[model samples]
Target: MEWHQPPAALVRTMNVVLRGVLPSPLGRGVGEFMLLAFTGRRTGQRYRVPVTAHRVAGDLCALTPAGWRLNFRGGADVDVTLAGRTTPMRGVLVEDRAEVARIYLDRMTELGMRRAARMIGLKFPLGRLPALDEVAELARREHFGVVRLSVRT
Candidate 1:
Protein backbone atom coordinates (compact mmCIF):
# COMPACT_ATOMS: atom_id res chain seq x y z
CA MET A 1 0.00 0.00 0.00
CA GLU A 2 1.06 3.58 -0.60
CA TRP A 3 2.02 5.72 2.40
CA HIS A 4 0.21 8.86 3.46
CA GLN A 5 1.65 11.53 5.71
CA PRO A 6 -0.20 12.52 8.81
CA PRO A 7 -1.27 16.14 9.01
CA ALA A 8 0.92 18.63 10.85
CA ALA A 9 -1.75 19.33 13.45
CA LEU A 10 -2.15 15.62 14.14
CA VAL A 11 1.56 15.14 14.56
CA ARG A 12 1.65 18.00 17.04
CA THR A 13 -1.21 16.55 19.03
CA MET A 14 0.48 13.13 19.04
CA ASN A 15 3.72 14.59 20.33
CA VAL A 16 1.85 16.16 23.22
CA VAL A 17 -0.41 13.26 24.12
CA LEU A 18 2.16 10.52 23.56
CA ARG A 19 4.94 12.40 25.31
CA GLY A 20 2.78 14.01 27.96
CA VAL A 21 -0.30 12.08 29.01
CA LEU A 22 0.56 8.55 27.95
CA PRO A 23 3.77 8.40 29.94
CA SER A 24 2.82 10.36 33.05
CA PRO A 25 -0.92 10.20 33.59
CA LEU A 26 -1.30 6.75 32.16
CA GLY A 27 2.07 5.48 33.38
CA ARG A 28 2.70 3.81 30.02
CA GLY A 29 6.10 3.20 28.54
CA VAL A 30 7.61 5.50 25.99
CA GLY A 31 8.34 4.94 22.26
CA GLU A 32 4.81 3.71 21.72
CA PHE A 33 2.69 5.32 19.03
CA MET A 34 -0.15 4.38 16.69
CA LEU A 35 -3.36 2.76 17.84
CA LEU A 36 -5.08 0.84 15.03
CA ALA A 37 -8.74 0.00 15.17
CA PHE A 38 -10.27 -2.16 12.47
CA THR A 39 -13.45 -4.02 11.79
CA GLY A 40 -12.73 -7.70 11.87
CA ARG A 41 -13.21 -9.18 8.42
CA ARG A 42 -15.03 -12.15 9.85
CA THR A 43 -16.83 -10.67 12.81
CA GLY A 44 -17.54 -7.25 11.30
CA GLN A 45 -16.85 -5.77 14.74
CA ARG A 46 -14.37 -3.19 15.95
CA TYR A 47 -11.05 -4.16 17.43
CA ARG A 48 -8.31 -1.86 18.60
CA VAL A 49 -4.64 -2.81 18.70
CA PRO A 50 -1.63 -0.70 19.64
CA VAL A 51 1.50 -0.74 17.52
CA THR A 52 4.91 0.87 17.45
CA ALA A 53 5.33 3.46 14.72
CA HIS A 54 8.30 4.52 12.62
CA ARG A 55 9.03 6.97 9.84
CA VAL A 56 9.74 5.04 6.69
CA ALA A 57 10.84 7.36 3.89
CA GLY A 58 8.77 10.21 5.43
CA ASP A 59 5.61 8.15 5.89
CA LEU A 60 4.53 6.56 9.15
CA CYS A 61 4.69 2.76 9.15
CA ALA A 62 3.47 0.27 11.70
CA LEU A 63 5.25 -3.07 12.14
CA THR A 64 3.80 -6.36 13.21
CA PRO A 65 5.26 -9.77 13.92
CA ALA A 66 3.88 -13.11 12.86
CA GLY A 67 2.13 -13.21 16.21
CA TRP A 68 -0.21 -10.46 15.06
CA ARG A 69 -1.37 -12.34 11.96
CA LEU A 70 -4.49 -13.38 13.80
CA ASN A 71 -5.66 -9.79 14.00
CA PHE A 72 -3.97 -8.12 11.05
CA ARG A 73 -4.02 -10.60 8.17
CA GLY A 74 -6.71 -10.01 5.53
CA GLY A 75 -8.05 -7.03 7.50
CA ALA A 76 -9.18 -4.02 5.47
CA ASP A 77 -10.14 -0.38 5.90
CA VAL A 78 -8.32 -0.07 9.23
CA ASP A 79 -8.90 3.06 11.30
CA VAL A 80 -5.76 4.54 12.82
CA THR A 81 -6.08 6.83 15.80
CA LEU A 82 -3.24 8.98 16.98
CA ALA A 83 -3.48 11.22 20.03
CA GLY A 84 -7.29 11.61 19.94
CA ARG A 85 -8.06 11.82 16.25
CA THR A 86 -9.08 9.01 13.97
CA THR A 87 -8.29 8.66 10.28
CA PRO A 88 -9.37 6.20 7.63
CA MET A 89 -6.71 3.71 6.61
CA ARG A 90 -6.29 1.01 3.96
CA GLY A 91 -4.80 -2.26 5.14
CA VAL A 92 -2.34 -4.04 2.84
CA LEU A 93 -0.72 -7.31 3.82
CA VAL A 94 3.07 -7.39 3.58
CA GLU A 95 5.26 -10.52 3.61
CA ASP A 96 8.68 -9.33 2.54
CA ARG A 97 11.27 -10.35 5.15
CA ALA A 98 13.84 -7.64 4.55
CA GLU A 99 11.14 -5.03 4.57
CA VAL A 100 9.49 -6.47 7.65
CA ALA A 101 12.80 -6.78 9.44
CA ARG A 102 13.80 -3.24 8.61
CA ILE A 103 10.79 -1.89 10.49
CA TYR A 104 10.58 -4.60 13.15
CA LEU A 105 14.17 -4.20 14.23
CA ASP A 106 13.77 -0.45 14.32
CA ARG A 107 10.78 -0.76 16.61
CA MET A 108 12.31 -3.40 18.91
CA THR A 109 15.52 -1.46 19.31
CA GLU A 110 13.77 1.87 19.82
CA LEU A 111 11.28 0.47 22.34
CA GLY A 112 13.87 -1.75 24.03
CA MET A 113 11.57 -4.73 23.74
CA ARG A 114 13.84 -7.00 25.76
CA ARG A 115 13.89 -4.65 28.71
CA ALA A 116 10.28 -3.61 28.30
CA ALA A 117 9.15 -7.21 28.17
CA ARG A 118 10.86 -7.79 31.48
CA MET A 119 9.01 -4.86 33.01
CA ILE A 120 5.72 -6.26 31.80
CA GLY A 121 6.38 -9.74 33.21
CA LEU A 122 7.02 -11.26 29.81
CA LYS A 123 9.92 -13.27 28.51
CA PHE A 124 11.78 -12.75 25.27
CA PRO A 125 12.15 -15.87 23.17
CA LEU A 126 15.81 -15.25 22.58
CA GLY A 127 16.38 -16.38 18.97
CA ARG A 128 13.35 -18.59 18.99
CA LEU A 129 11.70 -16.47 16.34
CA PRO A 130 12.96 -16.83 12.78
CA ALA A 131 16.44 -15.59 12.11
CA LEU A 132 17.00 -12.80 9.63
CA ASP A 133 18.30 -15.12 6.94
CA GLU A 134 15.33 -17.43 7.39
CA VAL A 135 12.63 -14.80 7.59
CA ALA A 136 11.31 -15.28 4.10
CA GLU A 137 11.60 -19.02 4.36
CA LEU A 138 9.75 -19.10 7.64
CA ALA A 139 7.15 -16.70 6.36
CA ARG A 140 6.42 -19.05 3.50
CA ARG A 141 6.53 -22.18 5.59
CA GLU A 142 4.32 -20.72 8.27
CA HIS A 143 1.75 -17.98 7.90
CA PHE A 144 3.88 -14.92 8.66
CA GLY A 145 2.20 -11.73 7.52
CA VAL A 146 1.70 -8.05 8.30
CA VAL A 147 -0.96 -5.48 7.46
CA ARG A 148 0.38 -2.07 6.49
CA LEU A 149 -2.08 0.78 7.00
CA SER A 150 -2.16 3.72 4.64
CA VAL A 151 -4.24 6.56 6.04
CA ARG A 152 -6.34 8.41 3.47
CA THR A 153 -5.68 12.12 3.25
Candidate 2:
Protein backbone atom coordinates (compact mmCIF):
# COMPACT_ATOMS: atom_id res chain seq x y z
CA MET A 1 0.00 0.00 0.00
CA GLU A 2 1.23 3.48 -0.83
CA TRP A 3 1.53 5.97 2.00
CA HIS A 4 0.84 9.66 1.99
CA GLN A 5 2.60 12.36 3.97
CA PRO A 6 0.63 14.68 6.13
CA PRO A 7 0.65 18.37 5.31
CA ALA A 8 3.98 20.06 5.94
CA ALA A 9 2.35 22.48 8.32
CA LEU A 10 0.90 19.66 10.34
CA VAL A 11 4.23 17.94 10.42
CA ARG A 12 5.88 21.09 11.68
CA THR A 13 3.21 21.58 14.27
CA MET A 14 3.61 18.04 15.55
CA ASN A 15 7.35 18.47 15.71
CA VAL A 16 6.83 21.54 17.84
CA VAL A 17 4.40 19.77 20.14
CA LEU A 18 6.56 16.67 20.45
CA ARG A 19 9.66 18.76 21.08
CA GLY A 20 7.92 20.39 24.00
CA VAL A 21 6.10 17.47 25.55
CA LEU A 22 8.36 14.49 25.04
CA PRO A 23 10.89 15.88 27.51
CA SER A 24 8.45 17.19 30.05
CA PRO A 25 7.02 15.73 33.21
CA LEU A 26 3.95 14.76 31.22
CA GLY A 27 5.99 13.18 28.45
CA ARG A 28 4.71 9.71 28.95
CA GLY A 29 1.18 11.02 28.61
CA VAL A 30 1.68 11.26 24.89
CA GLY A 31 2.76 7.64 24.67
CA GLU A 32 5.53 5.98 22.66
CA PHE A 33 7.55 9.06 21.83
CA MET A 34 11.06 10.12 22.87
CA LEU A 35 13.83 12.47 21.91
CA LEU A 36 16.88 10.82 20.43
CA ALA A 37 20.16 12.67 20.41
CA PHE A 38 23.06 11.44 18.35
CA THR A 39 26.10 12.73 16.57
CA GLY A 40 26.51 12.12 12.88
CA ARG A 41 29.14 9.54 12.09
CA ARG A 42 30.81 11.29 9.19
CA THR A 43 29.88 14.94 9.65
CA GLY A 44 30.08 14.89 13.45
CA GLN A 45 27.00 17.08 13.58
CA ARG A 46 24.61 16.69 16.48
CA TYR A 47 20.94 15.92 16.05
CA ARG A 48 17.93 15.61 18.28
CA VAL A 49 14.99 13.92 16.68
CA PRO A 50 11.64 12.94 18.06
CA VAL A 51 10.58 9.39 17.29
CA THR A 52 7.70 7.07 18.09
CA ALA A 53 9.07 4.13 20.02
CA HIS A 54 7.66 1.03 21.61
CA ARG A 55 9.32 -1.27 24.08
CA VAL A 56 9.64 -4.71 22.55
CA ALA A 57 10.93 -7.48 24.74
CA GLY A 58 13.59 -5.60 26.74
CA ASP A 59 14.48 -2.87 24.29
CA LEU A 60 13.01 0.28 22.80
CA CYS A 61 12.39 0.14 19.08
CA ALA A 62 11.69 3.15 16.89
CA LEU A 63 10.21 2.61 13.44
CA THR A 64 11.60 4.98 10.83
CA PRO A 65 12.27 5.37 7.14
CA ALA A 66 14.10 8.69 7.33
CA GLY A 67 17.58 9.27 6.10
CA TRP A 68 18.87 10.20 9.54
CA ARG A 69 18.38 6.59 10.57
CA LEU A 70 21.46 5.85 8.51
CA ASN A 71 23.49 7.12 11.43
CA PHE A 72 22.74 3.88 13.21
CA ARG A 73 23.36 1.63 10.23
CA GLY A 74 25.95 -0.47 12.01
CA GLY A 75 24.90 0.53 15.55
CA ALA A 76 25.81 3.76 17.29
CA ASP A 77 25.72 5.31 20.72
CA VAL A 78 22.83 7.60 21.47
CA ASP A 79 21.14 9.51 24.26
CA VAL A 80 17.43 8.90 24.62
CA THR A 81 15.40 11.43 26.55
CA LEU A 82 12.06 10.21 27.71
CA ALA A 83 9.75 11.34 30.45
CA GLY A 84 12.22 13.96 31.62
CA ARG A 85 15.11 11.51 31.95
CA THR A 86 18.06 10.93 29.67
CA THR A 87 19.90 7.67 29.27
CA PRO A 88 22.71 6.47 27.08
CA MET A 89 21.82 3.69 24.72
CA ARG A 90 22.91 1.94 21.58
CA GLY A 91 20.77 2.11 18.45
CA VAL A 92 21.01 -0.39 15.65
CA LEU A 93 19.07 -0.04 12.45
CA VAL A 94 17.24 -3.15 11.26
CA GLU A 95 16.72 -2.65 7.55
CA ASP A 96 16.09 -6.20 6.53
CA ARG A 97 12.60 -6.18 5.03
CA ALA A 98 11.49 -9.58 6.26
CA GLU A 99 12.65 -9.01 9.82
CA VAL A 100 11.19 -5.54 9.83
CA ALA A 101 7.90 -6.96 8.65
CA ARG A 102 7.91 -9.51 11.45
CA ILE A 103 8.54 -6.90 14.09
CA TYR A 104 5.89 -4.60 12.64
CA LEU A 105 3.32 -7.36 12.57
CA ASP A 106 4.18 -8.34 16.12
CA ARG A 107 3.76 -4.77 17.26
CA MET A 108 0.44 -4.45 15.50
CA THR A 109 -0.72 -7.62 17.18
CA GLU A 110 0.41 -6.35 20.53
CA LEU A 111 -0.82 -2.79 20.23
CA GLY A 112 -4.10 -3.41 18.44
CA MET A 113 -4.40 -3.21 14.69
CA ARG A 114 -6.26 0.10 14.40
CA ARG A 115 -4.00 1.95 16.81
CA ALA A 116 -0.87 0.54 15.24
CA ALA A 117 -2.10 1.35 11.76
CA ARG A 118 -2.82 4.94 12.72
CA MET A 119 0.58 5.42 14.27
CA ILE A 120 2.59 3.54 11.66
CA GLY A 121 0.90 4.84 8.51
CA LEU A 122 -0.45 1.44 7.61
CA LYS A 123 -3.71 0.96 5.81
CA PHE A 124 -5.83 -2.13 5.47
CA PRO A 125 -9.40 -3.28 5.72
CA LEU A 126 -10.92 -3.30 9.15
CA GLY A 127 -10.80 -6.56 11.14
CA ARG A 128 -8.55 -8.22 8.63
CA LEU A 129 -4.99 -8.86 9.72
CA PRO A 130 -2.44 -8.35 6.98
CA ALA A 131 -0.26 -11.26 6.06
CA LEU A 132 3.48 -11.21 6.65
CA ASP A 133 4.05 -11.35 2.92
CA GLU A 134 1.99 -8.21 2.41
CA VAL A 135 3.89 -6.42 5.15
CA ALA A 136 7.23 -7.60 3.77
CA GLU A 137 6.28 -6.21 0.40
CA LEU A 138 5.42 -2.88 1.98
CA ALA A 139 8.69 -2.85 3.90
CA ARG A 140 10.63 -3.61 0.77
CA ARG A 141 8.90 -0.90 -1.22
CA GLU A 142 9.09 1.69 1.52
CA HIS A 143 12.54 0.97 2.89
CA PHE A 144 11.02 1.26 6.34
CA GLY A 145 12.23 -0.50 9.46
CA VAL A 146 12.97 -0.10 13.12
CA VAL A 147 15.96 0.93 15.10
CA ARG A 148 16.41 -1.27 18.11
CA LEU A 149 17.69 0.73 21.04
CA SER A 150 19.11 -0.89 24.13
CA VAL A 151 20.65 0.52 27.26
CA ARG A 152 24.38 0.66 26.96
CA THR A 153 26.00 -1.88 29.22
Best by lDDT: 2
- Taken over the whole model, the C-alpha lDDT of each candidate is 0.52, 0.81
Residue 83 displacement in candidate 2 (angstroms): 2.0
Per-residue lDDT tens digits for candidate 1, residues 70-150, read 555554677766544557887776656667655443444445645434321223455333345554443345443456777
Q: How far off is residue 4 in model 1, in Å?
A: 30
Model 1 steric clash pairs? none
Q: After superposition, how far is residue 37 of candidate 1 from its true place, in Å?
A: 1.2
**What digit string (tens of lDDT, one per residue) describes model 2 on residues 67-134?**
88889999999999887788899999986778888998887778776777767766666466678897
Cα deviation in Å at residue 39, candidate 1? 0.8
Judge candidate 2 at residue 51 and give its lDDT.
80
Please give the range of 10 consecutive residues that has the lowest summed lDDT in model 2: 1-10
- Each candidate's root-mean-square deviation in Å? 10.6, 1.9
Q: What's model 2's overall lDDT?
A: 0.81
* Model 1, runs deviating above 4 Å: 1-31, 66-75, 106-145
